[model samples]
Target: MRATFSRKAALLCSAALISATSVMAQDADIDSTNEDFALDEIVLKKSKREIQTETATSVTVVEQDEINDRQASTIAELVDSVPGVTIVNGASPQGSGINIRGFGANGTYGSDQKVLIQVDGASVGSEELYRISTQLFTDPALYKQVSVLRGLGGSFEYGSGAIGGVVLLETKDASDFTGGEVGFRFRQTLQGSTNGNGFASSSILAWQPTENFEVLGNFTYNKQSEQKDGDGNVIGNSAFELPSWAIKARGYFGQDREHSITLSHTDSQVQDRDVPYDSFGTTSDNFGNVDRDIDNSATVLTYNYDSLSSDLINLDVQYSYADQQIDQTYVPGSSPLEGGPSWPFLEPLVNSNHRYETSKFLVKNQMNFLTGGVSHDMRVGVEVSRRERLDASAAPGGTDDRLAVFVVDDIDFGNGLTITPGVRFEDQNIKGNGTYAGDYDNSAWMGGLSARYAFGSGFAVFGSAGYTESMPIIDDLGTPLFMTQSEKARNYELGFSFSNANVFSDADTLQLKATAYKTDIWDITSYSNADTVETKGLELEARYVHSTGFYTDMNANISRGEEFNAGVATDWRNSPADSLRLTLGKRFGETLDMSWEIVANAKMDRSTTPTPSFNAHNLRATYIPQEGAFKDTEFRFGIENLFDQTFTPHLSTRPAPGRTFKVSVAKTF
Candidate 1:
């Protein structure tokens, strides 16, 4: 009920700092027609995504309403609904990796991730071992907003060479429940699923003692038995028991409340006893089962200052630290221990403890001015981060430090014409000690230009081009290969967008956005022998809504690419399979709404072996009364994989979950 959104309307309206309307700090009305579902611009009391109807970028924002309606059991199910985004090894928490446009790192032995995943703007996740994951793990119930930017445009402020784009997860604040007023509120949700026999209990408590302060805390407990495919085969290492909690608080000060400070922390963990050693797709005990305890935690402190009378002094500062620790030990009754196996199993591996941590400090400011009769909005920022890996069971340990400065400017020359330019200067150092003592350093620059022209007819065209580079990291577990140079890439994107109202009737609206992109990267990776890789893809999004409650939303994506070594194709994993999804829905008055979604994926061409294609269907519904006894309560039901298709995803080895029946109820007090 607290979410407001706008689609990308122009190329220069940075989605990271969205603005809805001119007004600020407005109360959101729940159980009412809160806001437009397809607005040309979105503003949410302050801190809203204001992508206009003619936006040219491929930025997608998800609100709390959709999150609740999905009833997702994990982050994997919550995300990946977007086109060109896929999860690697999604069967278990230990290996659910992120892949965007075929450019993510996972199912590998080193931490060479290309995608940037962050919670509250704090980067997280590291993959240095064979079985460890390179994705963040948390309770989705703690978040209020989810943003996904799909393209190579994030390298400037998000990372050194994040060609796979960025994912931002924003947690719910106390103001969400009490509407920024002095009050106390609590909400509880109970959910159950049939296929995996999964059950979850989530609770939240919010309090605002005064107009200047607010606080919120949430806790969740979720558990599941081994999941089965449509064919009724047990998924390997798919069951888990998770307990997570988050606490956030904020205080406002200074004249006219122009300054504020916020502090937040979150912790989540999972414990598995005698699970499959190959958390991948294989159920065969090639090595053996083990006991694993994975814990993830993060803490963040942020400050914001905006001048009420001036438009140039908008500043933000943040300091954050995140850690992911995995402790796994040999099981006495496991396959290797019981069978007394040979070869690798005879190497005697036990009590393996690995810890990955990230510490970051960031400062940024925005200013508006006029130059040469053109209106300009400029933003500049500095980022510093320390990434460390500590391994006790064989994998190598090292640290990576990065310092970067980035600046972007939006120049508007009237007549619906806006051009944005950005640049980044970065330096990175990776170091190891003792037996693997070594140091690698690199400095690079990245920049790009984007232009958009919107006509009075509600149609827009935009284009962008940029270049970036990726620095080297520490060597893998016992591998002796190290690189001296960084990987480089040149990226290009072109798009068209249109938005119109009263297309079908006086109460209907339509929006469409499409993009085509290509990226060329050259360098030697830690494990790969390829010299160059090129990827190209197309993404499309379309939606239509009417006053009668009938609506439809659709997304389609196609990706293709290849890696070349001496003119011979060697790898194609950078190309995700083509995917499409369509959702149709209707609102039965203000008390109920329902949606049916159909999703399909084409077989992947990323390897020599052919990965099969598959399709799925889902149904979802939510009911909330306006003036009845259930005004403050909600009930939801869903059916996923409705046809029981037993097919695996292109990037995953485990079969997809079979037919799942889900139901949940939430009550507010």
Candidate 2:
């Protein structure tokens, strides 16, 4: 199954690229920029600066326009379209995991993403609660750009969990001025061979009253009905059926709005279920319904000041809070055992709730210096943050807190070379009043260096090395039954990029980039069997762009990783050895655009592992009529899992949705 998916992905990628080239050839004045086209103009979220091609670190900027063109509904879907990133779906889009550079978050509790998520420089998770959800920022229409910073540069500025990288999300700022845009979309999906259906809808609105003062607001509501098998039987032997819903909102404000402030909230609930597998086959039973709820909110304020003619400084202050609750009830037949009790028969219930809050402040400064007839652009910053959390259950409650300070500096050499070095220090404390209780304090330091040297106008070589560490999660510090030792990691990488102004023709330009990277993780965090272990691997990504309207991007990564325990057994849900993504986009005339994307991953062959390799292709076409109320209107249609492949990407989890099709329309005033 794995090999077949790989081959199909390769073929579809090739066909899409060929189609893009043909479309580009038909365009006139390929240099046109007023149409808001140009890959180099891509915005980044890491540095809070708009850097053109050839300067920033290893970064992948996925623009909202591109996201809209692909008709993506979730962050996982969009990130999977990019090269070198893997997204594992647990049961539904709401319960998904993302991995980069061979490092991913744990899936058991839906916690453990190695990449940290940030919105406009403010951390998006609760400091006291470690398993916070990313669904708070689900409205993609509220974002201006999504930046994926890979390697050391990412770890240096973002801190430890960023060992794999950092995903910085910048939402629309109010200061952008007095105007508003509103949009709505709906979608339907089919779960491959299952007799189930899913549907979703979203709406968003953003506005600015005057320069420096603006407000943006967004809300999304979604619900999926229970799903059953074609034979009227429950699939996966899941204890509960597939029914869930979510809601989210955010607001932003600033003076003239130079100094900015923002607030956000999110909530979600799901039914309970169980999985059963044997030599015969795999299935799920709908035992009963489980109720899960998550609520999160944050406030951030930032001030930018011009200290001197040649210097700039900025200060930021933020506060955030989150709460999570889970309630589960067991149904009798929900258990796979023979003659198991029927639904709602054996009523067993468990409830857990967690609360988290954090306060942080940081200062940044930039200056220009000249020496030895060479000019240098330099930047420095300092940060401090405090976080606290409380977990409550029927037994008792647990609490943990931490404080940290960090600094960073970046220097640019006039000759197309720039280097950055940074470090952070953290102080942690823990206390418990339940079955497991203790108090401990520890300090950790992390740092890295990155440099880029351009050889000519169209080529550059870059390399970096960094060390990062993550303290144990709050729950991991309880008692022997709950506590786990801390884990740390170090990563090193090197790569190069090539660009040509007119590689194809005088009116055309082509850009190609690739990178090779390796990461070593020690005392890696693992659950179930082993408490700690080690893992390592390499990743590569390449992209080609033609100014004549053709663009192709491809990424591939494979790694060999293992848990060291002579007696303990572990499997694939912990990690995957291989993953790949390919995407192609083209503009056909002034009113039409088309794109295709392919995603595939290798199966976990280890005895303890249970996931199988699978591949899926998506085709999208957009039409903009040249007349009537449809001038700025667009019609989008696409089919996912073109071959109707039925497989699971996670161990014994929900199977991938089978062959799904969707169509939607968007109009911009």
Candidate 3:
């Protein structure tokens, strides 16, 4: 059955690709002979705003349109499609973990999260001793843009513990709904999936009292039952119910409305029953269950001054607060024979509940300026955070206070060459109020340097090297507090980008980017300096677009990671797998867009036992009414795991979903 399904998918994809290519070629030949074509552009802010091509780091940007195109239910689904990145799935509502260049794939504490998640200039975390999963906890519809920074995170402007990388999420603005005129707008959407009988609905409202003043709000509800794997067997403990909402208010001031302020708040919660025990824990084979509830809320206030009067400087200031808590009750389940000898004796000692809470308050400023004959962009900021374990289990609730200041400078030399350098200094203290806490003060300085040279319009080369000294969080300083010193990392990377508008034809465009990097982290999970972990990898991406609206993209990555022992590496688990993704898409007229994607992975040797690889296919389509009665309505549909191959993702033990169909409808007025 699998073979037959696979062949059918292959045939359909081939036929669609050939048909679309032929039609697009003829259409472009006549209508786009003199037209200009180029790949999509991505801009990110590390220390300052810059195009991805001009930056010395690997960056991936997912725009709001792409998010809508995929109809992603979670942030993990949106990011996992990017090259060189992975967010482990399986856990409902919230994903398990996020891995960047083979980091942040282990540990329970939220502080152990290697990748930083930022939303609208504010960081997100639960700060629980058993930290909540970093990705997929919030609804994807709340954000307008998601950007991933690979390799060295550039500067300390984003706070600490970003030795792996950083993820920046930009939330939707009232301006996104309200045009330049003052009015009211509303949007409604409904989506459903077959695998888990999942359903979701969202409503958004925006009101512009004046051209320069606007308010927006969004609410969403999501629910899913048990999911079925590729073999048509139910995957236990894969059900959840979630609700999320957000509100924003912004106003423009000053003569030309160059000065602006924004205030926003977001809240989300997840409820799940029969939650499975951690698959990576000491009770790996245990069949225990828990009733879980997690909640997260954040508020941010921002002010911006563009300085229309002076070209010397522009300023942005922000203050944000975020809090999260987890509540869970373990339920008795069938005794596990493999759960050690104590499982049987403790079978009746269930129904216990635990609570954890954490919060953070941060304020920062970004200053852009030009000094002397050189252009400089800088950021200065400070942050404070606290975490507590409400229901003491092993560690008592504690408070951690920190004061941090950081500065980064992007210097332009004018001759197609630019250099970026930065440093951060922090003072941190941990106070134990509940169970275990000692008065300790820690300080450290982190710094990095990056350079990029654009020799021509479509070609650029870049390189970077950096070191980060990150202090332990409250979770890391738990119980016995086995760790005393801060964790540190040395990172380096080099890459290039190329683009051509006439790669295949005058009306066609092509772009390519490739990068390689290596990172050595000290004291990642130990106090001993002799323990070192190293990760290295290469990522490549290529895209081609025809003026007639046909496009294709290929992304691939491979790497290796391990712990070093006297210059020798052991227990290597790098590169997860050599994987490649190919996508073909075409737009029909002004109403329809269709796409097909194939993902393939090569076998990987993660341990003494190698993991097998697999291939998967997906198809999606979107339709919009251009001028008919349904002009303001849109429809979308897709099929995932077309072949229904029963395979697991590399570094993951949970089985992926089977062939599932999903659809959605939306209307705006």
lDDT winner between candidates 1 and 2: 1
In the range 583-660, model 2's lDDT, one tens digit per residue, is 677765557767787887787675365567777786767777878866856677777767766766643244555565
Q: Quick one: how many clashes does candidate 1 have?
A: 8
Which residue pairs of candidate 1 clash?
7-51, 8-55, 9-52, 9-54, 9-55, 10-55, 20-42, 20-43
Top candidate on lDDT is 1
TM-score (C-alpha, index-matched) for candidate 1: 0.90
Give the TM-score ranking, best first.
Answer: 1, 3, 2
Clashes of each: 8, 33, 1
lDDT of 3 by residue, 560-630 (tens): 87777677767554346778988888877657889998989888876544778899999999899888889
Each candidate structure's TM-score, on Cα atoms with residue i matched to residue i, is 0.90, 0.75, 0.86
Runs in model 2 deviating more than 4 A are 1-56, 125-142, 174-198, 226-289, 306-310, 322-349, 363-387, 394-397, 480-485, 524-536, 566-573, 602-607, 610-613, 650-652
Off by over 4 Å in 1: 1-54, 89-92, 109-111, 333-351, 475-483
Q: Who wins the TM-score comparison?
A: 1
**Candidate 3, superposed: residue stretches over 4 Å from native:** 1-51, 107-111, 127-135, 279-287, 333-364, 387-391, 478-483, 526-530, 565-568, 573-575
Give per-residue CA lDDT, model 1, range 1-669, as digits (tens). Answer: 333342233312423334444323332211111122333333222111223344445677777877888898777676677766887755456567778887775555323566777899889877545655637567788888788877765447677667777788899998999988899989999999998799999999999999999999999998889889999998777788889999999999999999999999988998889876556645356557778888998899999999899899899999999999888887665664455545354334434677889999999899998878787888899999898888454566788889999998888775677788889999988787566767777789988888888765557788888888877765442444444677788889998877655565655656677889998888756337688888899988887666576778888998888888888976576466789988888877656878999998887766765587888999999988777778858899999999998988776756788999999999988
